[model samples]
Target: MIGDSNRKMQQIPPLKSIQAFEQVARFGNVAKAAEQLNLTPSAVSHQIANLEALIGRALFVREARGMSLTPAGEQYQREISGILQSLALATERAGSAVGFDCLRLHAAPSFGLLWLLPRLDHFRSCHPEIQINLSCSYETLHFGRHQIDVDIRHGYPDWPSLEVRTIRHERATVLASPSLLERIPVSQPSDLLGQNLILSEAALVQWPQWFAQQGVALPQAPFALGFDRSYMSLEAARHGFGFALESSLLSQDYVKRGDLVPVFPAELSTPVSAHHLVFPRGHAEMSRVRHFLEWVQGQLGHVFNY
Candidate 1:
């Protein structure tokens, strides 16, 4: 059994190409990397090319003064850097083989609690060493004071210095429990007006907005119940109290799990985009933040403009 296991073990790889790739990523210049490694610029470039070929992905965006890492290259560089660091410290810095990275992520309460919290384990499964410090609230993040690595914000993207990417390309629709639907049917858009409509003070798109899309006029009366957060509204709706107008992206699990259902056909739904990934220019360069963002990009089904 021991002999078989040893025979199945993969052969040791050539570390020269990996080193060359890391050096180029570090300096963003073949000449500078070659200078440090005591090799010609051509040799450094050749080694990186071999590494890229072996991995089957371009690692750099070649430019005039230097080369910049591509998105894939950035992630690869981060992983390779950690491994190389571990190898270097193996003999000298015992028990400190792998590097630990921490990501401080802040997000809207509903998204954090209902959506991200459930899926986070998948990220942990892939990157067990990456530590995540997550905070959820409706208030805007104070980047400097909070020391947030990145944030997920809902509503319009209007920060002055921060960059924004729309994380959810989704629809705004009326959702209700089967029991609630049985009590008050919603065959048309105006039918929701008669039912107990849930109100969320923190919602990016409200009942009025959703009704307006269907050319239905909403009344000035109060809702059956109101809440300060979207999660509460969704939970109330899921319990059959009333219908809720929410993002298809945020309410996906509820609908899938049979806790809630879309009241209208998809044709009646309105295209609404609210959730966004927000970060400073320099923060995107950090390995931990970049890694999280990349993983987030993979979580959503539709991730472009709505």
Candidate 2:
């Protein structure tokens, strides 16, 4: 009975020691494993030493080249790796079975309202099983704090520490209410000079940029009403308050309904503001992430022409 008890005790490793050694062995560097495991290099080294002592064997040979696993260590490493992989797979399967495959989506408020919200039903139809939690705000999101699975942003596509995919391009155009258009006949871009201009604080330079693109000198400080958000500016324009520079994509529904009219027959177009889909760099291998990205790419169709 004592012999059996001793054998059982020998078969089981000190779990903390074994875990540290496995990480170090798999990475082939104590420092690298320590970083990944959120432990110090010294701590990892100490754990490895304790493991070697418990097993009554030296697992690694420290050399000028680097640490190398001994033959016995290599054998033990293979077994440990198999065990870890099995545990990971089992955990993943259990999580999935419990409907824990959730995706945290972050998006800018105006873009979410005008563009993404309209098309999100399609994504829902495609990924009915994947729960998506969307956090919409006007400010830039901190991906680490929000634990965001994906971020949809409208900008230059140069976000740090993220994998970026250009989902769509954007163009800007002047939109005015049909009532305002009826009152003042605007046949060309220059005709906008006499109209009350509505401006979005977020896109203050949009009109100036559009005028520059058309090679038309903007009237110095035209009478304008300014709002903090694009959606509010668009709302003001819809109510016949004034003309506003709006995304061709977002203005299409109103334009088609004759609620809004474009200032010029030839719409002022710009190099598409790259609407990007971003995610954490290291999560590219996750199956759910891969699937969602593929779906997003497939759904990207040019919904506007100006």
Candidate 3:
């Protein structure tokens, strides 16, 4: 019995190999997986090879187009993915248990940078006993599978089986640098027709919606500069590139700093959507999660009157 147990333990693959395989399985491209793991393509291939040897199965089917998981690979992924995440959480908790509490939080890229990051110092000062591991991504993660404590998502509250709350009402408003607005006068929504509009890919409200709300007509195929994230749009607005439609709450800091100013005197805000705090059901009972949730709500409410 002792010899059998020793042999079984020796068969286990290295953690690095498993991590590399998991990333490759999810991404379906070694280069993409390598980028995520900060490893080279050859190194990722080596790890995958090592893992396959340990399991005695081909984990991935290499193809001309891209890689696809084999049946065994898929089965292995489904079994081990959640386990790996749980292991990570356990490891983090072990460290926290020794000293301070730990909270694993995720947020959308722009919101993390423009909004949450600015106020994290305040949270740290208030909750000195808790350690926060904050991650930013545009892709929606499986809250339970990824073991995320809280996710700050910008969209309708439609995530099934999750406790969702509207943390901040995202008011879409037109903003531009004071210098830019001065050079190209924009007294009314219609005045913005001929001006360069900085478009954000993540914008919940578009130019047409804003124009329609103001009872103004939109030009067909209007010329505009596009960015993938809100932070980029805000930066463009600051540099006097063009007017951008974004969250009033997100732009508040910029507005206060005089980097950007509201386009219209009337606070024309779009009511299409808002920011929601999402977590797995029953997680609100956790002290760390609840504390952060309440604190963020108060902070955002003060910033944007949500």
Candidate 4:
């Protein structure tokens, strides 16, 4: 009698068929569900049919326009949605524990260069069980389609449907080689007029913007040099090329090592700009994403507030 009961339980619909029904219910169309599942429409329809046969009832009402869930299908979906979510979470946790999970992180190029890459060694050392893959890009990446677990971007809070955490509030200041400072002393913003002004695309506030913020109009266009990255401008400044306005957080290491000296005592606080970590709305709870987020927050605790 127990064996018969076990055999009957084994006759339940496959998980894939249930998944197909769920996706179809979500999109209300086989084609759209197929696209998400990476299967053909016919396959999605076939799966739903198989599922319906197992339940001894039609799950979806076939229509000329598309498909709609039957009342039974809607009820089933309501019940199974939470089950699938829990199963997925459990599977992810298991995969991460077994070292089979790979966390993908995307970051702005400048942040990746000056901030994340420098500190990733400690993260890797502590969490040797988890693997990390990092990609740097200037373009905005969406969390869902891009499969990005975390994205570190330099911007204000504007992205929608993503969890945004401010990693650092940026303040820009003029920095230069000590030797260059010896040649040209800056007492006020106006004194920067004749000096070489290095501008970087990656800067939260550039030379022009910083000067304007300081309430000093450049009497003349200073001899300007432009670089595509903030690090490049800092490198040029280290070689005594010119003065560069840089974020204090990015220049902390250089300042400590005496590679760059502040040309001015004044700092231009950027009220509307900051470094933020973004994640898909629901992904933050996943073990892999949660681990990385906690590690990063801990590493930058001094620099960032929750």
**Evaluated with lDDT, which candidate comes out highest?**
3
Writing each residue's lDDT as its tens digit, candidate 4 over 1-306 gives: 999999899777787887788778767899998998899999998998888888888888889988888888877775554345456546666766455667788988878888788888898888776688899987886343455778888766775335688866557778899999888877787887877888877666666676677798854764578888777888898999988877777777788899998876644444435688876556677787888888877876653443
Candidate 1: where are CA atoms >4 Å away?
Answer: 1-98, 303-306
In model 1, which range of ten residues has the least summed lDDT? 84-93
- Model 1 steric clash total: 0
lDDT of 1 by residue, 71-144 (tens): 98877754543454344423333544467566778999888988899999999998888888899987885453
For model 2, the run of ten residues with the poorest summed lDDT:
297-306
Where does the lowest 10-residue lDDT sum fall in candidate 4?
A: 265-274
- Write candidate 3's Cα lDDT for 146-174 as tens digits: 67888888766675445677754557888
Q: Residue 122 in candidate 2 has what lDDT?
A: 81
- How far residue 302's Cα lies from its native spot in candidate 2, in Å, is 5.8
> Which model, 2 or 4, shows the larger TM-score?
4
What are the RMSDs of all candidates, in order? 13.2, 10.6, 7.2, 7.6
The better candidate by TM-score, 1 or 3, is: 3
TM-score-wise, the better of 3 and 4 is 3
The residue ranges of model 2 lying beyond 4 angstroms of the native Cα positions read 1-99, 282-284, 302-306
Q: Would you give me the overall lDDT of model 1?
A: 0.78
